[model samples]
Target: MISIELFAIGLVLKGPEIPWWLLALVIATGQIGGKLLHYYAARGSIRLPPFLRRKSANERTGRWREYLEKFRANCHRRPVWTGAVLLISAASSLPPFAAVAVIAGWAKVPLVTFLVTGFVGRFVRFGALAIAPGIVIGWL
Candidate 1:
């Protein structure tokens, strides 16, 4: 967790030499941290902090109800996939973090699944960015 925070700090500081190990460390930390946030919300141990608690949470919860209409659902069904999707969305800024995290919490998405999915999603996304640059640059 601290390492992830440090990564963010390093980004802000414009420091060089973000090691490969730190990159993996941060992604793993971020995924786990995101899952814990959802779990705590589900367990009722924590209240949504002011930024996270709002009409948005309720709105997303309502949206999840709509998703449930399709079939029986629980947090565990595709933890890795769901986590990947949510984290990918968050990482890519496709959806607001609060919407993703809060709805995921209410949906009871299992910790393990989300962690796996989110990790893979983030890994693939980042990995693609790392690996595809040469191919992309060549096309230009």
Candidate 2:
């Protein structure tokens, strides 16, 4: 999503004018859809025999385990923190949304919660970008 943020901002700054609400809506929809796909993909992979297989000694697999462990711990012991983390991940570039969404899915966060938070966060994120040029130019 960060990959496309700059381009969206550039369009807002240099291309034809677009309503901020429309831009934010479109961006939020695309981002949420992308994240949902990522979540389901992660869920599906976990259900696969190969993915559920015993962990190997590979460094990459080790790192993945660490991520999952942290995710599980956060979900169980610090649900508020997990929610904040997910919200921040949705709203910003730090802690890639794909990873966060996958973890959320694995942690069994309710689908309604995921979608609502994701949509709201993404709306704010893209809304900020969409209006940045206006703010900078004192047009808003």
Candidate 3:
């Protein structure tokens, strides 16, 4: 949910003071770690607060849950497509990776699939962001 682009760009601008790949790895690790927590929470491995549970049962939440159920059905029927969506969300944040994580967890997506896709996507995303400044400066 939080945007870390500025921080990553700042690290890149440090000009060899920090390794870009290392920065990308650290950022990706933290991002995936947080998403994993969301996944576990949605998977029922972590207990959510009572208020959250109550809110989730509301009409609005119910509607969203219904939609998510459909998505889960599709995930089972089309795993490769689901993985592609997850990868895109993880890398681009277009559909919001946090929401995707929750959806994947609720869908009971294989843990290995979630972790591997998430890490690879996040690494690529952050790595690109970290390197962008240098590439642009080179152009200038």
Clashes of each: 10, 0, 0
| After superposition, candidate 2 runs with Cα above 4 Å error | 14-16, 45-67
Instruction: Return whichever of 2 and 3 wins on TM-score.
Output: 3
Q: What is candidate 3's local distance difference test score?
A: 0.89
lDDT tens digits, residue span 32-121, model 3 = 999999999989899998877755435645677688889989998998998899899999998999999998998999898899899999
lDDT of each: 0.56, 0.79, 0.89
Error of 1 at 52 (Å): 8.7
Model 3 stretches astray by more than 4 angstroms? 55-63
Tell me which of candidates 1 and 3 scores higher on lDDT: 3
lDDT of 1 by residue, 1-140 (tens): 36443554445335435544455556656665865676568546688667766665556456656785332253356555566567676556466544666566666666565555556555654444443434554798
| Candidate maximizing TM-score | 3
* CA error at residue 53 for candidate 1, angstroms: 8.0
* Residue-wise C-alpha lDDT for candidate 2, range 1-140, written one tens digit per residue: 25778878887877647898899999899989989976776666435467654475565457767878777776878766767777888898568877789878877776776888788888989999998888878964
Error of 1 at 11 (Å): 3.1
Q: Clashing residue pairs, candidate 2?
A: none
Candidates in order: C-alpha RMSD to true structure = 6.4, 4.0, 2.2
